[model samples]
Target: MTDATARPVRSSPRPTGTPLRAFGALMLRDTRVLSRELLPFIVRVIMQPLLFLFVFTYLFPRMGGGNGMMMGGGSFATVLLPGLMAVAIMFTGIAAVALPLSTEFGVTREIDDRVMCPLPVYAVALEKICFSALQCIFAALLVLPLAYYIPSTPVLLHVSSWPVFVAVMILASLVSGALGLTIGASVQPRQIGLVFSIVVIPITFLGCVYYPWALLSHVRWLQIVVLANPIVYMSEGLRTALTPGMPHMPVLAVLAGLVGSLAVLGTIGVRNFLRRVIS
Candidate 1:
């Protein structure tokens, strides 16, 4: 017979750890995987900008006997410097999250296993965005030094304010990550290529990457129209910080656009992620 005074022992708490710990662990795992794929990652980030710079800034000038002038009068490479960085950031973010995520959400349903971590489902989504943002940062930085070395003509980059430069880099990276999440969640695996063809190409061509927004006076309607593209702000914002001697959008508008884009995209991505997971 059990002793009358003996009480039932309480069970121990779960060893699952806190949500933040799980979130960090998820990111760490992704980081480890990325470390193994370093060669491919470097190749993917550098190829587009390197080839474009080689052709346009180096070969084209030698072929054409001159370079195109930017809006406020600078070498094409000057314009391309910030613009290419922006593209790298945007493309890296999309590739980091959207491409793999589409496959995970496909027949594999690998995303289900990821969401089953002890952390909240939204935290899992946030992990994707945050890690993608980090890759965006790295891809963008890789583009930065290339501008100095790649162009036969000088790529003039004058950073008047380091704080502003850093801030734009961060906000723009996050915006791209959020945009990636939205794309990843909305587009099925089969349809993602279509997204790049229709959505991404159009936006990039129209995003004022090769020119300044202020120079669009000749095409006022098109200028007004392209403002709707988040990439416009990124290119413009970077142009402002990196090439201050050149004309750029108002600082207020750049900051506002980045903030607004982040908010809108983040909300939509989280909602779509939740719906996809729950359904």
Candidate 2:
């Protein structure tokens, strides 16, 4: 009777939903949040590119700057368009991942909720990368049309190869996303502004945003130095894809560099993110 009363207990099995489902759920949630903030996102995405177009492509040309002479006979607008697009994508990726991550890792402690989910810790970092990459793509699309039509100086853009253009855009966005993840995970909340000044400012100006990478050849050492800046490849890749007739970096080199950057930065970012979350 005593033995019968002490019945065996069975532990319940874990939940049945797959990692895919969890990832999808998290993505969907992020999409919904993005949708709600669509207006601000659009404004943020558009503002910098708009200023660049207005000042460099429009006002400067009208103010006696030669329309195309600055960039080796290619229309300044044409040269600038791709660089501006790269800037938009880069900024989108950084803002999409970094700011929220800072807050989550800061006093809000919201990251706990995310890590507590059924998904693996690395999946959370991956979700950030994917989400930011998508945002970067969308930003690129928006900037492309605006860049083509909005400039008062007629911009001549010819896609030499659609495949190359697509490849550059996708690869650049991924690199940007990975960079954002690494920066987000590594920077403390209080040092965010300093990091931007020290890291982001130099990247933007030295990124070949206002000029072509090939133009650096006149200053031999600069050409070699700028090669280390990932954005140079992105800008050059876009220049190659969009204006193949103009001087640009070799396509194979750009592609190879981007792939390498993605691997290294993505690995470091995920490891740092895991450390931050687990600690």
- Give the alpha-carbon lDDT of every model: 0.90, 0.87
- Score candidate 2 by lDDT: 0.87
lDDT of 1 by residue, 100-161 (tens): 88998999799999988898899898889999999999999998777788788888878888
Q: Predict model 1's lDDT versus the native.
A: 0.90
Deviation from truth (RMSD, Å), model 2: 2.2
Model 1 superposed RMSD (Cα): 1.8
Q: In candidate 2, what residue range of length 10 has the lowest lDDT sum?
A: 65-74
Please give the lDDT score at residue 104 for candidate 1: 89
